[model samples]
Target: MGERLIVIEHEAEAGLGCFAGRLEAAGVEAEVVRPYKGEPVPGRAPAGLLVLGGAAAAWDDEGYGWLPATRDLIARAVDEGVPTLGICLGAQLMTMACGGTVERGDAGLEIGLGEIEPLPEAAADPLLSALPSGPVRAIQYHYDAMTTLPEGAVRLATGARYANQAYRLGDRAWAVQFHPEATPEIFASWTGGGDLPPERAGELNAQVEAAGDELRRTWGKFAEAFAAQLTRR
Candidate 1:
């Protein structure tokens, strides 16, 4: 059988939309496992590990019974040199598992479409090296922040509000605070009927709509690069 990318879905709404398609297009099979729906967290890491975003905070292990196991799975993948990608909550889990800290963002919730500034180190990084210079636009929706990165983790991307927007752990493990897998429709499902004011929500919608093409162009390359890395392994 072809190599499989294990996708840990924390929530039903936060499915692997664009990422799944891009990975499949690159000849990688994505096998989704919903731990939230009573699916067991794989004890062993697969060829590739993809942990999607979630509404729960990383420290909410008691609330989300599966978080602790998922975190361990991420740690094992990184330790064993598996190509791993974590988004939002997934990023937090990866960070925490790797001796980093996850805490609430005192700057409040960072929602809506925003630009992430890639650090100088990203110029030669494997996954982020494919991105264009200047601020990379991405969808953001998270209340938690990775306060401290793991030992020797290279910080790749930053934002005006969040300093730790992306980082590379070990060799093949990557964790991003932004949501590259989120499309406009998926983002709408996140912020459409929330407590956000109608005007603010509309503005966010317009911003995402305007930047949709660019997001796909840039993040698509990033996703494909991830898949390419998996294939190389």
Candidate 2:
């Protein structure tokens, strides 16, 4: 297998942040394709595939013309047993592609540093098992949630607001509703656009900054585990 991983970057601000460093450190090369910027999304992944989060909703095919193609790419990856990781919007897209559901969260926007409770199934998961035992924390910045997982999808972790925090579809595809790739700086940029009230955004950013070390350790290991998967292929 090639050392390259195909990465779908939905927007400029949402590009791979901390996770890019982790992949590089693990000796994995990432080729970022920005469909929003007019770059064509590849139909196949030579080694692995990573679909990053975005501001657009999973169902915004009309608004974002490239979404249909992206979803098609995800379906092909899972069908072919390619190592695939979907984050936030990417996760929702995976759900829709695999006959599941995603909708605007009834509980409202789940933005900030949140704890994820790994289910019993996670103990045996190849990727989530990399997280340290006990409660795991990661960045959360999404309005939509995966209400239902795809058929045969194994739920790995859950949160108070959203039950489908993480899941594994097929043998090689994994999806997470949270943004493990976001750094405090990248998160601050996301909130800087007035998505949340100024004070609330400040509070969330502070929380993320305070938990920087733990986020790095937890999500960094997760990234490394994914990189290991690419190598094994």
Candidate 3:
């Protein structure tokens, strides 16, 4: 049977966009599982688990009651040796699952573009090591951030406001605060109000125009990273 990629989508339109497309381009079967819609509980594990970015917090109120259970699902996936990746809210959930705490960070609203600095030890990480120096121009959209690092997790990358931008737990599980898969639709839907300056509209428009190409190149790196985990199997 072909390998399966488990994706837990939290929001209505916050599903993986370019990330999913890139996986398909690589001939990898990517299956999206909508847990919030009462989809099947992520069972039997999978080759990997990708938690997409979302506005909803993992620890939200009764509106998202399935969140706590989703944590169990992610932990189970990790326990089963399935490489997992959590983005944005997914990253926070992963941190909490790994015994880390997530609280309202003082970073305030981290929107628009941002820079990330990889830790020294990250040069040895399988996935992170593949990345080069200098800042990776990725779209950052999040109100909450991780306050503590998860046990056995090394900080892969950090930014000015978000210290825990990227992290790796054990050998396979990973989480990133920024959205590498943020397409124009995803970006626009998540953005609003005077939170971000309106002057960035032109810049945002350009990014949207080049979304296809950007997604291809960026997701290529992500797929390469994920593929490394499968090779170890």
Candidate 4:
């Protein structure tokens, strides 16, 4: 059926920069749509769905005034067995749809580069089978976290603040709480027009580069696993 991947990004500039390219290398066409500005959510046609991280939250989707229907559509896509990779807010939304809990973390922010320990279950899933065993580098930028996992979901990766940094539902559906595909260009876009300070920019850039390195080291494992799952029985 010539499958494709739809990336539900929150902002135009902050879409799947490196992740899209990786998907292309894996023989999948990737398209991006920002729902925060009323971008249309496509139906059950994509080979997979990769929802991106954003400055917004699962609760703040209503504040953006463009998430309810979008999330519903994502939920439907996952139920129909579209390979899904939810990052940050997208991850939180998946949790909400699968009947989990999303709450502001009292543990403060997950800023800059952080570590993720892949669970044993992750080693068994097609989405994470060949991925790094533990403590992979990831870009972190949120204060909210998913406290509960969705029904029938298996925790894939975790860290100090969030124990469920990554999850999988069956072999085809997956969600990663961190940005495994964040690239330098995408990182620049997200940091655009912000008065955050030059020093912080350097720090953030370093973190982004570190995240990219981790992906470079590990995405082939994930890509192979995912594509194999797509062609599975």
User: For candidate 2, what is the TM-score?
Assistant: 0.98
For all predicted structures, in order, the TM-scores are: 0.97, 0.98, 0.87, 0.87
CA lDDT of 106 in candidate 3?
Answer: 87
Q: Per-model C-alpha lDDT, please?
A: 0.92, 0.93, 0.75, 0.72
Candidate 2, residues 1-233: lDDT per residue as tens digits? 23799999999999888888889988889999999989999989868999999999999999999999999999999999999999999999999999999999999989889999999999999999999998799999999989988999999999999899999998899999999999999999999997689999899999999999889889999999999999887
> Which residue pairs clash in candidate 3?
none
Write the residue-wise lDDT of candidate 4 on 1-233 in tens digits: 43466778887656765555556666666677766666777765346777777777787755777667657867887788877778788888888877889999878777667778888777667677677566677667778989988889888888987788888876567878877666666666655557467788778877676557666667656665665554442
Screening candidate 1 with a backbone cut-off below 3 angstroms (N, C-alpha, C), the clashing residue pairs are none
Task: Arrange candidates, best TM-score first.
Answer: 2, 1, 3, 4
lDDT of 3 at 45: 55
* Candidate 4, lDDT over the whole model: 0.72
The positional error of residue 82 in candidate 3, measured at the CA in angstroms, is 1.4
| Candidate 3 runs further than 4 Å off | 192-216
- Candidate 3 contains a number of clashing pairs equal to 0
Candidate 2 overall Cα lDDT vs. reference?
0.93
Q: How far is candidate 2 from the true structure (C-alpha RMSD, Å)?
A: 1.1
- With a 3 Å backbone cut-off (N, CA, C), the pairs that clash in candidate 2 are none
Worst lDDT 10-window in candidate 4: 224-233
Q: Which stretches of candidate 1 lie over 4 Å from their true place?
A: none
What lDDT is obtained when candidate 3 is compared to the true structure? 0.75
